[model samples]
Target chain A: MALEANYGMVGDFYTQNFTTTHTGDGDTLILNLGPQHPSTHGVLRVVVELDGEYVKKAEPVLGYIHRMHEKMGEVKTYLQYLPNMGRVDYLHALGWNWAYVGAVEKLMGIEVPERAEFIRVITCELNRISSHLLWWGAYLLDLGAFTPILYAFADRERIMDILQMVTGSRLTYCYYRFGGVSADIGEKFISDLRAFLAQFKARIPMFHELVTGNMILRGRCVDIGVLPVEMCRRYGATGPVLRGSGVAYDVRRFEPYSVYDQLDFDVPVGKAGDAMDRYDVRVAEMVQSVRIIEQALDKLPEGPFLNPDLPDRFIPEPGEVYYSVEGARGKIGVYIVSDGSPKPYRLKLRSPSFSNLSLFAELSQGTLLGDAISIMGSLDLVIPEIDR
Target chain B: MATLGQTIKSLWSMVVGMKVTGIEFFKPKLTVHYPRKEVDNLGTYRGHCDLVAREDDPLTPKCIMCGICVDNCPSGCLSLTMHVVGEGKPRPAGGAGELMLAQEVILPGSIKKAPPTGKAERVLDSFRLNYNYCSLCGLCVQNCPVSSLAWSREAYLVGRSRQEFEFDLLARLRAKAASSQGVKAA
Candidate 1:
């Protein structure tokens, strides 16, 4: 029943498609777009049936960069596999780490102090900004603009510097421990972060002035890839894509964790469920993240970063829990089943991009080829995150 | 027809874009000619590690040969050895100092950590950096508890000999301090 709900079969649309009762005969031409082609973003192969450039059907082919990360999680001890969490979606490494560490903490029942929770929220929100910045840059680059990428990187570099002082690594940070973060942030860390926040807040408006208002970008995005609010509900879509379609569902707001309940920030939504709306939603989210970072900083506390009761080997009781975070692309969920051992019994990942990509077919058909790529660009589908 | 209006609008947008880019062209070029530029300084953004020594305490006990840095090393590129007068490998009393095996290996996250055989000393042995495979990710340098191992700002690390790249980084650092002192005195 899950499989049936998860996927449905479709052929060339001649008004007879999805009508199981109809009987008709028509020629169907299969069009394959990249397992190796440049446009599908990163190593994604899509099979599309074209009625002369008007796509009648679309099917995405995946499992190219599948590294069996969940299986590896079950083998490695909690501390040992912390680094591997970053490799899932390298762009939003901090959010992924937050989810993994949050799950482990839940299983162990460790209460993080006020200071650590505040710090985690600040860092996670900063990471969310960085992720959104990269996505916006990449999305524009995909749409044939170059300058916004550099602008995005300029802002992203500040976040990297702020993170590196405490986390020690930039791109892939193995900073967060099982119970809490490894090191206590120093004076320099907080000061530098404040400066970064001030500078970043001033620069965010430029992004709006640049692409969001650009006539070309608007014409390309506005009505393209219209995924209605109801379809989003059926597919269990989360994050900006779901929110963009006017569904008031956000993992951070719904399942508040790591001092998120303490801080106040608005979840931006859009009325029109189109490509432009998704773009607007993500940009607005960047502003909201800045707001969150400000609140977290203002209420910063002083205390221990790590839990006092943290064990060398984190062994959880025989139970299961699913922890999720609103990653850059969508909701990244980690399902862990522990048999009261050092390693997890069975681990499953509910990757957002994978489910997000599944909807590509619904949006792609009855659209031009250019519109399809535009939809893909707007979706911000990181192939590694999907393939993971 | 849709064709004439669309073409005119496209032409107008192109003109506006070109005008913007044209104004940018007059402004001092932010376009960095990365390959052509001679100034190798990466400007305050951490480029490489410099080994410094204290002036007052000539031989400022910089490293006590504690295995903290060794254990913390993500890649096996860092190595340190403390001399014990006359041990397995003799110390040269005069001239260019004696060559002895070290305690720790400080590698730049270039290679995976070889599981330590329980029999081997907890201290560093010899830091063998396989430069052939080094991605220069700088994880080892960051994780190095002592803050010794570093990403050489010398962007071009394509060395001729593997041995030339593979140095006793800690000893070389200490020796570098000593030689700089000698130059200052002279």
Candidate 2:
């Protein structure tokens, strides 16, 4: 009864601010979903107000794993700050690597070699597929499916092995330099990738048959937490979340950085704008990524991996530039302001997960608590990316 | 009835899902029993940076006491202390051969070089690497002018305390050099 009284006070406060009245006679229970819970992905706390099983209001509190990456950029030199990109989003690290490097390259008026450009495309796409695979596995796990994650990890491990040959580190890859990539992709890497592509093509259909076509999965996902395209626009949600809302707006297609302009790939768009649509969009995007990687590998040219003439201390002239790369979660934009110094004057990271997670409260309103987890899963929120 | 048909269709779909796992049941297990079993291939796994010994002279380090790696380390994990060897001082027995060997290995086409000051010769006194803070980004190895530093490939490197990770690379190099010379003498 005392707990009910406290919950009533908290619910009333949220009700006044969020303007969602509790229709039930009893006091609405407040649930703190995580700052440590596994389903939240990584240290993301969601305070949900519930009337019985239905969620009245949901608020996501972030910054548990915040290490002040932007502040570190200002203190460290341009070359020194490169490793920080990998830590920002460990899943889709290469995208952040590309974003920071692309921004610096733009400011310095440096032209990356054609071969290096192709390598960047190949590696970044491979990373995107891995990110999506992990999401696919984790999302299914959230919905009470355990077998799919093992299969997902089986594919992901192989991809990580291929990436490791060139990137050096598996998870947090600081592979890309300002002018070009750190290492050249050898014949072994290329041949291994080709083999993986051939194998993964067959595996994709099996995944669909096992997980996608399951009636229970379809029941849980379809028509649940429908995020209309209008909400995506207002909240600035990009990547699969926007595509799931029937808006085929991808940063790779829209912005077209690196060798993405030359590569031919379809932007997968969903029709229903729901959890299932998001799942479908990510799955389709992975296929497109594989396609892009295949093309990039075939056209992989011969040249120096790193620019020979580039100085050890890469100092960009006094200028500011903004660069965006399509990460696994969404658009990862890096804005760097340099005062003709080795260290940045100011650095800002525009993380897609932050914007995508913002609309969760709005989307979670009046939905069942179970569906709330499904909506969160579909968004693919990386807490470190959001916090950073 | 329509409900009976719908139930059958759902059951059939469930059966179809079971077929995937059924097929995978006979397939070789992906899990590796660690400690006893290891992954066949490392696939360019980078562990930590270690000072590489000279090819011709196993007693000498190719690191010319240039602080490029020390200066460029993002995490400040690398620290170098350069000791200026005085002209007349009997150069630390077996040090002359090591210095000559080190110079021959490092001198050709390298950007950073010790000054021919005649009064003092720069020798790397100590090279400390804090493995705990190291991101293993390979910036130090990449920036090294003489290619002195390399990835260790020591995957199973472990310690009970944090202090064990603070490696004195120069001391390791000297110990290696001493052992090799002792083998030659024997």
Candidate 3:
């Protein structure tokens, strides 16, 4: 109705797909997984033509949760759109913010100080842990386990409290300025963070004992929705999903932005790239995050929180840059095109969830209905991140 | 032979997970009583923005209408106009003037105010702030030469109409002054 009557939406919607081609086949039955179904997650609708619970053909319909973040970035200034970055993925909020800001800084040649860099790394790692924790809980909940969600939330609240002290806001923090951070970290902030680290370390082993080795969880996840190592790279899957497929690639190690080069941490990988491998990789990654946070705290430097000499209005030289960071879900990146203006000429967010979700078509094909939801949970799709 | 060994390894891991969840099922719940027990650390960053007083010098920063704060403002929320009582014809502040010095003068402080050294150096007669476009990024507070401006912790700034978002900067100053006077009287 909004468009010219002559103009119409096309491609996947209008075209006759594989299910329709094989519509008369006696073995296949078509099933719509959602535009409202809980298992599909968010407003995602998957039209799965099934052959007795085995997905014969899966066509995922997008644009239901589309708020058009890229379009909004065109209208707003650099500082004006900082709040909208948080809306992209509220769970991995800090990670997306870090990637967006990191890209702009790179393009503009803004040098973040050692102290600010360390703080960024510490906060980013902590947020990664929080994101994974939520995923762990939600994955279990999707698999018919409710108690773990409450357990995960308890741990997540501790991380939120620590972040709130320095950032001021809880969910969406516009803490990172163009050059550096907004506020200085106090003595209380460090001590409180240290306490969280200790508690988190003690609790991690318990997670493995509770969920990792559970008979039911193992039975459900192990060898289910197996994505081969080749498929992970071909589809550009990231974070634990890529790591689970035995890829040693990590953006932090590869690019070395912020203080990531100074810090020492290991990337956890798995041999078989199954649902269980994804789950195990995430659990291990959380433990690794705790290690990184502890290292960052010990090496915390005393200096100016923000570069005091930065000009009020920032205009980067006309250039395009692709900067990425290992976020909770995957490698969140920003493809920024600057035309020597305070506002971006074109800002395209390369959302990891969007790329990670593309693997669904290949992986979900042979999996059962119940196992499909398990695979989706294991992938940990942040809907807004993909929509953005 | 390899398949059997792999199956045994999987079984062992399953047993480990069971041990952990089983232990949690017995542990006492660490739930908080929301209504009865209130957390004291709710507004940790609140009430930090108080007008810093320079007691020794009376002329330090009472209020001077040098629009440094107004100029640097991202939201364009501040407007300031000054009136000078000089030994000249009564007119607007920016008009031609050879001023006679008064005993007391409103000078813009270091935070939100800058020293008004010009001929039109005097108290702020009027001020305005359009809060509609203000996302409260705290750039205004940081840029204020004299620290008179602030965001209140009472962040319920949502209003039904656009007019409600526009605040009278002078009115807020007056209210603050009146409250201070009341406190002193008490």
Best by TM-score: 2
Worst 10 residues of 2 chain A by lDDT: A10-19
Q: Candidate 3 residues A1-388, lDDT tens each? A: 6244537533455245653467537777877777788765688777777888778767777788898788767655566567677778888878888888888888878888878888888887888899899899999989987767887998998888888787766676657776777778888889999998998889887776766666678778999988887898898998889998888789989888788888889999988999999998999999999999999999999898787677555568899988888888888888989898656899899888888889897788778888888888888987777777
Give the poorly placed runs of model 2, Cα more than 4 Å off. Answer: A1-26, B87-119, B175-186
Please rank every candidate by lDDT, starting with the best.
Answer: 2, 3, 1
Candidate 2 TM-score to native? 0.90
DockQ for all models: 0.08, 0.37, 0.22
Highest lDDT model number: 2
Q: Which candidate's DockQ is highest?
A: 2
| Model 1 per-residue lDDT tens digits across residues B81-182 | 444332244321111212222312222331233323343233333333444333333444543444445555554446678677655554555576779789
lDDT of 2: 0.85
**Distance (Å) between predicted and true CA of A330, model 2?**
1.1
Off by over 4 Å in 1: A1-30, B1-124, B127-186
TM-score, model 1 to reference: 0.74
Clashes by residue pair, model 2? none
Two-way DockQ contest, 1 vs 2, winner: 2
Name the 10 consecutive residues with the lowest summed lDDT in model 1 chain A: A15-24
DockQ of 1: 0.08
